[model samples]
Target: MNYTVNQSWKILLPLSHLSPNYLHEHQLFQRQTGKSFLRKIGGGMDKFPISPEILRPTIVFDNEINKVARALGLKGKRMPYETANGTLNVNIHYYFEKYIVLDVVFKQRISFGDISLLQKSRLSSYPEIESLVLAIAGLIVSGNQQSYSPLTSIPTIRCFSIQSLDDNQFSNMELVEALTGHIEPTQRIIDDVLARNSGHQTSGPIITLIDKQGVIQFIPNKPKLTKDALQKYSSCCNLLELMLVIEQSIKDGHLDSNNVFLSALKSLVEKPEDIVKSYTAQRTIKQYSKDFHLESRLSDLTKKIELASSVLISEKKTLRRGWDEFYASNDFFQVLFTALVAGLVTGFGILWAFLKGL
Candidate 1:
């Protein structure tokens, strides 16, 4: 199936590796940027222009670019440079401030035959985009003398695609499964959205969910829509760390165990909504740690995984016992049929003997 997708790369910083004081300073600077720091960075609050040279296939952050970054903090939000294929929008953690996101809006939406292939080529096919991301990261952490290294930050890719449907092409369930790669517990949400939008003459339904790799949103082609109007779907709870562990387990040849763990997790949740809520509620964020104590959170998740494994084993045993009883009943019927047939044959022989004697 072909899809037209809008792609973006989110580069998340390794918060654990950063210094507490450095983070605090950045926070203060961000707060003060509107009042005092704004004046300090440049003449006033205005958009800076990105260098055209950086748009070249091979980007080198020359001394001039470094000088500008040191003074202005790579403050530009728009990419003045454009390619025939698409235009780029670079945001330095504009909303979440946790990472930098490079959004690619194609002049004509880019086409892909397969989602997996598109994901794999996200960085490789666009070398210049990757270089631009690294350059921006370097520029952000350039002048700081803190022990934290920007190199620790790695970029993850996400994409939103639009696939138009023919009249009565597929049912809602089929469409949802096709778009989301069959991520469980999302169908209910999609149904709710579809119900809400029924009878209203508008675009098709949008389905979004978190897959094994990252978030995937399927949107109909609605041009000229504002970003604020966009309906972004996400897991209600922070299952990111849990997902990472599952992915790693698959890499280590624990696929069967992971499957059981996931199945148990789904079974444990009585309602679809519960799937979004965290497994545990006692988690609290610390002052120094940006990830809310990652190690501790992982340990908590580990306990849930163990519990899920046990539940799966119990279910398997129950299934086996049910099958055993079914087979045992069939065996009893077989034995009864054999005894009845032998008795009939003996009676027939005795009757014949009596008639001959008479």
Candidate 2:
């Protein structure tokens, strides 16, 4: 059965450097603003005041920056970036008048097969969606440089929520399978809060699955507070350097499904330790490549693998493994296996001839 998966990615970027005036200069409005409040903290009531002045500025862009502004694809509407297996719609929101929140939706129809395949879909879509986000970041950086001061750094966290495009009453097992691609126990975490507030009951429990990558959550079908929960758990995931690398890859026209970035991501989801080991090995090899005179050979091989468009990325791994096994076989065993395979073919051919004669 084929099911549609709707993966929602929310990138909450804090721009402390941006002000209402700056947003106004860019023809952007304060979508959200802070409010004054009084609260008891450490057994004392404290008051906090915030400016409520709303800024709505008509932006006048110079010729040089106008190109960058246009490149952002923000014309007061959502822009769609197509991926190999899905469509990603992007919209920018200035939240709390301080953060540039990117609301992105990736929709794809996938054939429901093995649970492992579900994980594959989720993993593969990330790089595609990430590339689009990085492209947007690169554009924002350019726009900021020309129109104002450049952004100090890229965001470090990624908040993601995913669900099937159906309203079926999700079973706990189903939720566990979808969230982590494994069948496991899921504990309800929001029952107490739900009991206190009946209004929040329909949103379902925020089930937490502590993964090495981060805290994974099996959210409710409603997805009302999933974003917030994910944000809280995903704060420690730093992707600054990764953002820069992908952004530069996008600029160099290497942001494709077959890129090493996607390969590394898939490997990360399965064997995270292998990724670390591979990185360490690569660093060691690079340090001694000149001494071993292996730099040119490694570079040439890498370029060949990356540039080969004839084979799909999904098959490349299997093909390489096959070749690796074949080359690792003993020379005598290789010849023996080849002869056995030839004998089988010849036997089949002779049998067919005999059968036709009879």
lDDT of each: 0.38, 0.41
lDDT by residue (1-358, candidate 1, tens digit) is 3344444444433222332223243421232222221122223211211101112111233332333333433333334334445555543322112222233322224444444433432554565555555555554554243322335335553443343322212245543453344443276856753453233212335544333334444555344432311323212012332333333333343433444554433322223222222211111111101132434534445566688889999999999998778668867778678889998999999999999999
Report RMSD (Å) for each prediction in the order shown.
23.7, 24.2
Residue 145 displacement (Å), model 1: 11
Which stretch of 10 consecutive residues in model 2 shows the poorest summed lDDT?
Answer: 36-45
Best-fitting candidate, measured by lDDT? 2
Please provide, for model 2 over 50-128, each residue's C-alpha lDDT reduced to its tens digit, 9 standing for 90 to 100: 1122222124223333344345443322345445566666555442334444545566665555554335334343654
For residue 305, what is the lDDT in candidate 2? 62
Which lDDT value does model 1 have at 244?
A: 39
Clashes of each: 0, 0
